[model samples]
Target: MRRILAVLLIAATTASAAAAGQSGKPRYFVKAWLQKADKTFEHTTSWCGPDQHCLVPIGEDMIELRELSGSSYYLRFISASSEDTPCCVFRNGSREARLESEYPRVATLYYRPEIWGGRGVTKFGRLIIVVEDLY
Candidate 1:
C-alpha cells in the first residue's frame, strides 16, 4: 500500500508539470530589427536569432528582443519617463510577447546606459522596459 501511494504521487506531480509546459504560449526565436520613431535615427540589437539577411524593420522605436538565460524573451525599450510608460505586445501569428509592468519606470527592463540609444533623447529618463516571456 505504501509503495503504491508513493508511485501515484510522483506520477501526478509529473503530469502536472507536463501540463504546465504544454500550455499554449508563443515562443519567438527569429531575427528582427528596429528603427527610431524619428527619421533622424535607427538601430538594431545585433539580431535576435539568425543573421540570414532577412532583416525586417519593426518600427522607429528604439527597441529589440533578446532571449534570457531562463529561456524567456524580453523587449528593451529606451525611454526616460519616470511616470511609467505602459504598452501592449502584438505579433503576426505564433510569436508571443507580453508587456511586463503596466507602470514602468527607468529600471523596469534591462537598462544599459552604455548601449546605443541608452541615452535616449526622451524628456523622460531612460526607460528600462521589460517584456515577459516567450511562454
Candidate 2:
C-alpha cells in the first residue's frame, strides 16, 4: 500500500507540472536600443518567458507589453514623469513612428524634454525596441 501511494503521488506531481508548462502563456525575445547622454545608442537584449511579465528596461525607464497577439499589443511606457515629457516613437531622427504590430519589427521611442519642468530632459533621445515571439 505504501509503494502504490508513493507512485500515485509522483505521477500526480508530474502531471501538474506538465499542465503548468502547457499553459497558454507566450514567450518573447526582446532587443532594445536606447540613446545615451552623448547622443550615442546602446543595445540591450532580454527574454520574457511565461513565468514573468514582459517588462523591458531602457536605461532608467521601463516599457511593458501585454496580450501581444497578431497586430495588437498593449504597451506602457514608464519613465520619470515629473517633467511631464511624453514618450513617443520617432523615425529617422525626425518623423514619428507608431508603436503598433508585426513581429520582429523595430519601434523607436523619443522622449522630449519639458521646457518648464524641473526634470530637465529626463530620459531624452530615441529608444528603439524590437520584439520577437519565441513561443
Candidate 3:
C-alpha cells in the first residue's frame, strides 16, 4: 500500500512539473520577407521565423508578427506597391510540414523555438528579428 502511494505521489509531481515547464515556455513570433527579389519587402520586427528570410525596403516602417507557436505560423503580407494586392502566405515548420506534403514551402521557418526564442522580455511583449534566404 505504501509503495502504491509513493508511486502515485511521484506521478503527480512529474505531471505537475511537466505542466509547469510548458507554461514557462515563452511565446514567440517571426518577421520574414515574403518576396525575395522585391526591395520593398525588406522590413524588421517581431513577426518572422528564426530561420526565415527577411526582405524590406531601404527606409520603411518595420512591421512584425507575434504569438507564434508549435512550429507553424500565419503570414500576411500587404503589398508595398498595391494595396489591393495583399497576399497571405501560410508558413509552417517541419513538424507541421508533414501535415501537408504538397507545398513544401508552406512549412514553418524555425524548427526549435527554445533554441531560437530570442532575447528580452519574450513573455509580455518581445520581438525577435532574423534575416536569411528562402531558397
Residue-by-residue lDDT tens digits, candidate 2, 43-100: 5555566554466665566767777643445555566446554554343333233354
The residue-by-residue lDDT of candidate 3 on 36-98, one tens digit each, is 323222322232234333222212332322223344333323333333322222233222222
Pull out the clashing pairs in model 1.
Answer: 35-60, 36-60, 37-60, 79-127, 80-124, 80-125, 80-126, 81-125, 109-128
Best by lDDT: 2
lDDT score of model 2? 0.50
Give all TM-scores, in the order shown: 0.22, 0.48, 0.26
lDDT of 3 at 12: 31
RMSD of model 2 against the true structure: 15.4
Give all candidates' CA lDDT scores: 0.30, 0.50, 0.27
Model 2 clash pairs are: none
Clashes of 2: 0
RMSD of candidate 3 to the truth, in angstroms, is: 19.6
> Model 1: per-residue lDDT, tens digit, 1-135?
534533333333332222223223333322222222333322222222222112213233444444443233345443332324432222221122433322221222222323324464232122222222233
